[model samples]
Target: MSVERDILAKNDREANANRREFSRLGIFALNLVSSPGSGKTTLLVETIGRLGGELPITVIEGDQQTSNDAERIRATGAKAVQVNTGKGCHLDAHMVGHALERLAPAADSVVMIENVGNLVCPSAFDLGEAHKVVVLSVTEGEDKPLKYPDMFAAADLMILNKCDLLPHLAFDAALVEANARRVNPAIEILRLSATTGEGMDAWLAWIRGGAVEARRRRAAAAPRAQGCACAEAAAKA
Candidate 1:
């Protein structure tokens, strides 16, 4: 117990540092987590397609092996860095920090970190994201949130993916949302089909809002040195 606590404590410290760096760079970082085959990669691809040109987007793909995900992200014309975790089940703050160094995302850019597919392990690790978005596919059933309460609880947003297949599947989307809210009442939910582009507008808008807020916070945090642009702007406001 003591060893586990110590390890998590160290991770928390590193996560705080990563958070500070993200704030300084005005990056809206998102950690996307889910079980394997939950369509996280597909969702990311669709998201990038919709917003890649509008926003300077970068991705850090985490997987046990292979850089396939990163390659796919790069094909979208966005910069991506792959962090092969090998035997590790999740990407910790230290690993994400290293990936950030390699990514070098532009200021005010949005960085999406696609975590290794695992509902259990990834929820326990903080990768210094502005929010943790969990993708749950309808094919996985409506009881997933109850089965993996920790993951749902840790997420700021729950994305019900593959909704276009709901007609073929018996999955109840409402039940899934209820279960997610049971674990995390404050969690915002979005239903979307990455394949058909349905419901993507809301998702893109949410990301835009977060990115705007990140830049706003960064500007507000800038030092008020005499004649500094930020300070001058603030004084004018």
Candidate 2:
């Protein structure tokens, strides 16, 4: 058991190192995870439309088959790479590491990784993202967090999409937020209707916030990881 735990811890540590390297390369990356039809692609397209030219943005779209999502992202004026995971259920850090070579975003670019639409598997894998944004829709029911706690717990940001049609559905928005909070106390929630553009600005602001924060953290940790033990400790601290 101790050996297994050590292996798992080593994987997570390596994933964290990859994330630091991505930051050091001047890339602001985000992993977008969600179930099918949860509007992850729509939100990403909208994000690209708003963020394009201002920042060089790229996307990696993962699916079991077809490059459909990557096609949509390409239409939004962002470079996109399609990764058909075959039998794999998640996009691990190693996968992202390979995809980054194909993506090749500019020095000050943002990379959005749209993971395969699985609430369970994707959350279990670390894709070396600065933040994991879980896209949950009102149509998916409010008990989703209870059904798939790992995804909610792993997410740094939660996007509740499709709020425009709330009156026609039986979905409980308050219950969803409550349950998500129970699983992830520190999650930043953004309720938005991607179709109607209702809450998009807030979500965009949160994305900007994550990018800025990631860059600042990377800059602050650069010089300390040189030689001394105290310096290494200070770099991480």
Candidate 3:
């Protein structure tokens, strides 16, 4: 118990530092979490294609072994750095901080972090992101949220991906939303299919809204130069 607590304590400190850096740079970061085969990478590729022209976006891809997802992200011409967490099941805050340094995303840009395909460990690790967006495919069971309550409870938004396949599956969308809400009453939900582009506008809007607010907050929090020339200029006028 002591060891576990210490581990999380260290992670929390690092997460705080990462958060400060994100704020300073005006970066809106999203930690995407889900089980394997949840179509996170596909969604990202589609999203980048749609918004890359309008928004400056970078990616930090997390996986246990391969750089496959990172390659896909790079194909879209967006900057991406792959973090292969060999034996680790999740990307810790320290790892993400270093990745941020390597990526060096432009100020007032969006940083998409595709976390290791796991629902359990990633929920407990804070990667200094603005929000944790959990992706759940309709192929998965409707009770997934109930089973993985921790992930749902930790996420700020739950994206129901692969919605275009709803007619072919036995999945109950309402039940899944109910389960997710049971775990997190305040969790916002969006349904979309990365493959078909269905319901993607809402997801894109959500990202845009967050980026705007993050940039606004960063500007508001920025320190003004001491004895600034702007005040002096105003006084002269």
What's the TM-score of every candidate structure?
0.92, 0.87, 0.93
The TM-score of candidate 3 is 0.93
Task: For candidate 3, write residues 1-237 as lDDT tens digits.
Answer: 444457488899999998988888888999999999999999999999999999999999999998899999999999999999999999999999999889999999999999999989999999899999999999999999999999999999999999999999989999999999999999999999999999999999999999999899888776463347678888999
> Which residue window of length 10 is worst by lDDT in model 3?
221-230
Off by over 4 Å in 1: 1-6, 223-237
Provide C-alpha RMSD values for all models, in order.
4.1, 4.9, 3.5
Candidate 2 lDDT by residue in tens digits, 1-237: 344356456557767876766777667888999998899899888888876756677999999889999999999878999998999887877777778888877765688999999999888778778789999999888999999999999999899999998999988999999999999999889899888899898877777776677667666666654447777788899
Candidate 1 residues 158-223, lDDT tens each? 999999999999898999999999999999999999999999999999999999999998888776
Q: Residue 17 in model 1: shift from native, Å? A: 1.0
Report the lDDT of model 3 for residue 15: 91
Instruction: List runs of model 3 lying over 4 Å from the truth.
Output: 1-7, 223-237
Give per-candidate clash totals: 0, 0, 0
Model 1 RMSD vs true structure:
4.1
